[model samples]
Target: MKSYTIEEINAILKGELIGHTTEKIVGPEELEKAQANHITFIGSSTYAKLWAKSKASAAIVNETLSVEPGDDRALIKVKNADLAMAKILELYNPPKPHFDIDIHPTAVIHASASIGKGCIVGANCYVGKDVVLEKEVVLYPNVCVFDETIIGEATVVWSGTVIRERCIIGSNCIFHTNVSIGADGFGYRPSDDGRGLTKIPQIGNVVIGHYVEIGANSCVDRAKFSATIIGDGCKIDNLVQIAHNSVMGRSCIMAGHSGLAGSVTLGDGVIIGGSASIKDHTTIHSGATVGAGSGVMNNVAAGQTVLGYPAQEAREMLKQWVAMRRLAKK
Candidate 1:
């Protein structure tokens, strides 16, 4: 029940307040559920219309909003209310420090491993032989860091994450729950007797760069010989599958369920929508946007927006659909 006066909140956000000064605010929440001590925000005029009925004690409203504040609630006006609210929320509820100065008793760190200073290994977490976890790394419960794996400083790995052998993850990265890095790639050869498949040895590992955020259940497969690399600031959504030897450039955004096949290369700032699948060895140039449900079979040029199977330009795909409809009517 931590509380801050409205004046303090205004100072925290550097925002100008338009209402009562002595009101106390605690945490931030949605307008519908925010109690007397909670502050909320309304970004658009559509939500501004509902301000009269909101239970929030205070609101961060954009300058353009014309809604009259209720007698019971206070309004703080700012240039970008949403951004201002985000800042306010950060001040009110700063992220809790996860890594303590000492490792938990249940954590298993091999005697041969080298764990750097300020690392927090949570309950049931395993740090294998020769593993290197740099300073300020936080591993949640049930995390497994395999042999020779190196996690850079200030990285936080959530529960159930498995960083396989020889993987190299960079600093300030966040991996959500169930993330699997450096897993064996889906590679196999026909057996000698023509009866079964033989697994190809995935001798390489995964390299994730600084500030990368991989969502829950996402997997980055290990390569056959080279690294499966994800560059700095890349954001991969949940359930995405990045295959062996795939190289994703900096600041790439991959939505949920997108699958990148082996050896595929995505240039910087590429945007892949949900459920998109790129063919093996394909190259998507910088700033390309692949629409949702696209099945990309060929290369996409830089700054292009592609859609549909064997993805074409979005407008072109729509035109082809129109032509197909007319032909079907014939």
Candidate 2:
């Protein structure tokens, strides 16, 4: 086990120490589970109130909170206790899985495919004709890169991911397990004979920017005629669905189970909460936030926050909810 002295830990956090201690802290733990050698964090008043009952020898406290070190306990005061705890956790994080810089014998690579220096193609992986894997790219087992696909440098694709033909993936991106990129859009029309539905041809590709991380089982569909674009720094959570021709700006965050209908446009820094569904052709402007479980039916202006089904302004929805509750009491 790794250990750090009180002074050494304070130096790492750059915090002001209140009361002095000579003991070493073994690791971090929650307030309810901390022991004498463990450290904990008090980020809000709720956690701060529990400090007196905790057995932790030391704690990282928010600078704005009024918490005193009792007896032999020490307090390291910082601007944000949660952020400080993240730094401390990094100190004790375990090593990640290592991949050797070689292609597995079980993997198949087309004669025309280009594999860059230091790339790793794991077992059962497939690289098709005219495919390009840039330097240091790592593809885990069973990943499929179709013909003419371009994967940028240093990108890591996990198991069971599929990049369809002619798709463009940017550098340093992470595609988690079972992710499906460039799948055909769900477009259909009535058949001329009035017997069955006719499928619309989807011939476009998916273009992802750098530093984006998509969670497990997410699907980003190909466009009808152009590219489905995902901007840099966008973080998409697990089980999400992004339809065809949707354009997302930089730093957009989509929580788990959120979905975007066809041709939906989102501006920079937009946040979509879990299970929220945006209507087709709707535009959500910069910094707009959609509440969890909301069904948006119209465009949202920049910096607005919408809530509830058929989502409206948050304040309006709250007012309606209050009135309904009062009416029920009568």
Among all windows of ten consecutive residues in candidate 1, which has the lowest summed lDDT? 93-102
lDDT of 1 by residue, 1-330 (tens): 678887778787776677673457878888888777788898997888777777777989898888666665677888998789778877767676555536889899999999889888898999999999999899998999999999999999999999999999999999999999999999999999999999999999999999999999999999998899999999999999999999999999999999999999999999999999999999999999999999999999999999999899989999999999999999
> What lDDT score is found at residue 204 in candidate 1?
91
The reply for model 1, stretches above 4 Å from the true place, is 64-66, 70-72, 79-82, 94-101, 318-330
Clashing pairs in 1: none
lDDT of 1 at 64: 84
Candidate 2 structure quality by residue, lDDT tens digits, 60-148: 99999999888888999999998999999998787756756489999999999999999999999999999999999999999999999
Error of 1 at 190 (Å): 3.3
Superposed Cα deviation of residue 258, candidate 2 (Å): 0.7
Best by TM-score: 2
* lDDT of candidate 2 at residue 186, scale 0 to 100: 93
